[model samples]
Target chain A: MELITWPDERLRRVADVIDVFDKALREQASKLEAVMRAGPAAVGIAAPQVGWLQRLVIVDVTARKGTNNGLLILLNPEIVQWQGSVIGREGCLSVPEYTGNVVRAAELVIEAQDLYGESCRYEASGFEARVIQHELDHLDGLLFTDRIVSRRSDLFLRQGGA
Target chain B: MAEHWFMLTVVGRDRAGIVAQLAQTLFRAGADFGEASMLRLGGNFTIMLMVHFPAGEHSLAESIKAVAEHLQLRVHIDPIDSHLHENEAADVVVSISGADQAGIVAGVTTRLAAVGLDILNLDSTVAGSEASPVYVMRIEGRAREGIEALEPVIAELQREGLDAVLHPVDMLIA
Candidate 1:
């Protein structure tokens, strides 16, 4: 699946909830997971990023150094609780050539559904929580640029993948 | 007409409509710019921009003369070699804070250079009252190697009597 870049009208629209856990929806999840797994640098991907309007996301940080829940396929995820705040630099596939410092919850408890439509709650902190927050924001039509600490100082021109 | 890049700067006492006036003048003058930075320091406002203008005998100074005089602002425009430039990527975020002292910038920058780190961006300021003051500086720099080559930098900076911390660049997220 081709990822949608920034300024695309589709990326700005809120994604629709996945009410049906059918084969097509599962196939979409696999496509998103394949996209995430294909890139050596990518850690997460959202439904809107792949031109889908449904609420689905894939997050896997095992390739890098971090405490994670392995590969997670969250359907219609919601943040039940969040705590603390920390500013961290973030880069997005949709918004290429730039990275910005964004303030996110240092820790959060997310309630989401697995691909099988089973409810699951995960308490995440550190990098895992940051990836989840970044991916979830896409569902609401919010990019990291919208949450940057300061446009003048926080935004930077990306040199490499990082 | 041949297109040319020029570095433009406007400085004056902080007031309203400065940006609007400058922008309107530049727009009317047919000066196009894509990136610029403006900030207020010590009650004075300064603007720095790279303007793309068609090269001609008449100068930009003559074009903005009316607005500059009316606002009592200083303006300068110089030709640039090229508009396309490479921006440095930061490998780590560095923070330094301590009691206000002279040559802190020079000292820290010298140390960074010696360690082969190129500074991408930096902001420094002195805060507090007349009796006491604090110097705080934040820097984004490119490290030749990874964080392993960076850990020693903070140790030497702290030895010079300043609090320092270095954090690796944030992970790449999809």
Candidate 2:
């Protein structure tokens, strides 16, 4: 599965919700994980990012130091509740070469389906929560650039070799 | 054919509809807004925009001049070269905060320049009371040198009574 880059019409289209927990949904989830792991420094990826048009996302921050939540595979994830707010810098695989400061919920409670199709709820905070929000935006046809707090002073180009 | 790109800046006392008025004029003149930054600093509102005009519009400057006059704002327009240039990703994001003092911005930016780091985006605010203003600055920049090279600059900022910290900006998703 090839990761869709920015300005690709596929990235902007709202993804379809995953209702059937069948073999195809499981296969797509595996492909999303494979594509995300193939990229360097990628902690999370969504189904729409790979042109699947399904509500599936994978997040793993275990490789990153100072972060919790080893690995999470959320299907049809939704933010059930949230509180507080913090501004943090974010970059996306789809929108390469640029990063922006975005305001996100400091902590959030999310409900999603597991690989086995069982509904589960979890609370996440700090970097974990931030990653979840970033991936969730993809399901809604939103990019980090769309949520930049201040375009003039908040957006930046990634330096070479970064 | 390459597109014509120009930088437009508008600055004036804070008022409503400044953007709407200017945008209407630009739209009527066949210009597309690219990346833009608009903010309120102190009592003045400033807008810096990159605009793209159609290939054959040579009178865009004149039209913008008329709009500037009608809006009672200071405007500056300059043509930019039509070349595709990409900035390197920044390695660190620095935050500095302390009592407001003179030359803080100049002092910090100069040190960054000496270390071969290009400032990608900078935002500073003076808060607190009128008598005791606290200055805070957030800067994102790409380090041409290694991240360790910024240690001395951070130390110097602290010695000058400003608290400064630098963190690496990870772009792993790309």
Candidate 3:
């Protein structure tokens, strides 16, 4: 599946409410997984990147997890509660090759739906929390670049790495 | 189609209308300030911008030079190969523990900078233990080509009495 392009009006479109658990939805989820895997380093993907615009995202912080571990599939995810504030650099597969500092909740408990249509709750902190929140923003058609808080003199556009 | 993406940063004493003046320059040049995060650190204002233009048509260095001179600000601009992009880079974990001191970051980053390493996450903590204060730091970054030779740099850091470790991070594809 071809990833959606930037400034594609579709990217800004709020995802459709996905209220069903069916074979087709699962197929779409698989397609998102494929797209995420196709990138050099993609941790998660939302349905919108594949042009579906559904309120669904899949995040598995397993690779970067030190203790907290689980695959998170959030449908219609919402940041139900948050505390404190922190800044972290983030990059997105949909936006391709640019990373920026984004201000996000230091800790968040998100209420969302799973692929099985089951309600799920996630409490995340540090990198895991940041990644989940980043992908969830995509469900609302938001990008990491949209969340930056500083314009420092040291950020570089990288090139030519493995 | 060649698309050019550049990370542009401006840092200097905080004053009035710096963002306005700098943004004006970029807009006049037909380059899109794709993304930006900026804040005032102490009395200095810093900005990180992801700017883009169609590749094969213009040089990012020239654009950065024009903007830097016009805005009268310190600027650093580097070209991001469209192929390597953001997601294609390799991640490395770096942990550093040392006596509280300045230039610990500078010492480590200076070496990584020479090799085109991109820092992804950096955390530094200096804690008071009621006895001996401890300073510790950990960073995640992506390595460019020739970064494998940084073992010597790590060895040098170890000599500074700072415990340092560098390991490649394998990203799991979704």
Candidate 4:
């Protein structure tokens, strides 16, 4: 599937909460997984990114770097607690041409629902935490560009073909 | 009414209500602002704005001149192509800092141009005391061919006694 990249109005819409978890939602998650894997180095994907305006997100930092819960397909995830903050560079499949520095919680305890509609809690830190925060922003109609570290750091120069 | 785009520049001594004055004038003239950059250097405030004015009637220049004269600011308004884009994402961010010296901007930028880097934004200034000033510059630009092309530029800049570092746009993805 061609990923929806920048300036697409759909990416800016706040997602609806996932309700009535069922086989259909599971299939949608699976399709989203395929899209994520198909992307170049995409660690997480949100439902709104694929044009599904529901609060569903998939994150798998697994073995790539940092300690992680492997694969998490969360619906309506919420961060119950957070601690520490670190700035890291981030790019999105939705916003392909730009990467920016964003400050995120270094550690977090998130409450979420699994694909089977079971409540799950995870204590995540480091790279895994950053990926979750980045994906989570998509649910609220925010992008990495919106959260870039500073005004001085957010400079963009006009180009002929831009 | 069709949109007529213009790039407006205003430079004058820093004073209170400068931004409000410009905003009020634009609002009254029914002008929509696009991307803009405003900064105060030393004692002067400078503004660069992309203005979108409905062109069915009315003199945009005359309206702008009245406000500029009242504010006692030097003003330049130039028509821009309707297809003109606001900006492009910078592919590389380069920062260099060292003891203050002459020709730093010119020498470094000339090398950047020779290496095919199209600068989008650059800010350079002196820091520290008058006797021991440090020249620091941050540049955001596009390396059209590829970032790999910047390898030698970085090396050369480093060789010249300046601390230079390059960060590629795709350094991280999540």
Candidates in order: C-alpha RMSD to true structure: 4.1, 5.2, 8.6, 5.9
Choose 3 or 4, whichever is better by lDDT.
4
Off by over 4 Å in 3: A151-162, B1-174
What range of 10 consecutive residues in model 2 chain B has the weakest lDDT sum?
A: B81-90
lDDT of 3: 0.69
Model 3 deviation from native, Cα RMSD in Å = 8.6
Q: Which has the higher lDDT value, candidate number 2 or candidate number 3?
A: 2
Can you write out model 2's per-residue Cα lDDT over A1-162, one digit (the tens) per residue? 899888988888888877788887788788889999887688899988988888889999887667576789998999999998866677788987676678789899999999778998988887788899999999998989998874333333222211
Model 1, runs deviating above 4 Å: A38-40, A152-162, B1-3, B55-58, B81-87
Q: Which structure among the candidates has the greatest DockQ?
A: 1
Tens-digit lDDT track of model 4 for A86-134: 6666778887656667788989999999888899999999788989999
Residue B89 alpha-carbon offset, candidate 1, angstroms: 3.5
Please list the residue runs of candidate 2 whose C-alpha ends up more than 4 Å from where it truly belongs after superposition: A4-26, A38-40, A67-71, A76-86, A95-98, A104-125, A137-162, B1-3, B54-58, B82-89, B126-134, B170-174
Candidate 1, CAPRI quality class derived from DockQ: acceptable
> Which 10 consecutive positions of candidate 4 chain B have the poorest summed lDDT?
B80-89
TM-score, candidate 4, is 0.75
Question: For candidate 4, what is the lDDT?
Answer: 0.80
Q: Could you tell me which 10 consecutive residues in candidate 1 chain A have the lowest summed lDDT?
A: A153-162
DockQ of 1: 0.40
Q: What is the descending DockQ order?
A: 1, 4, 2, 3
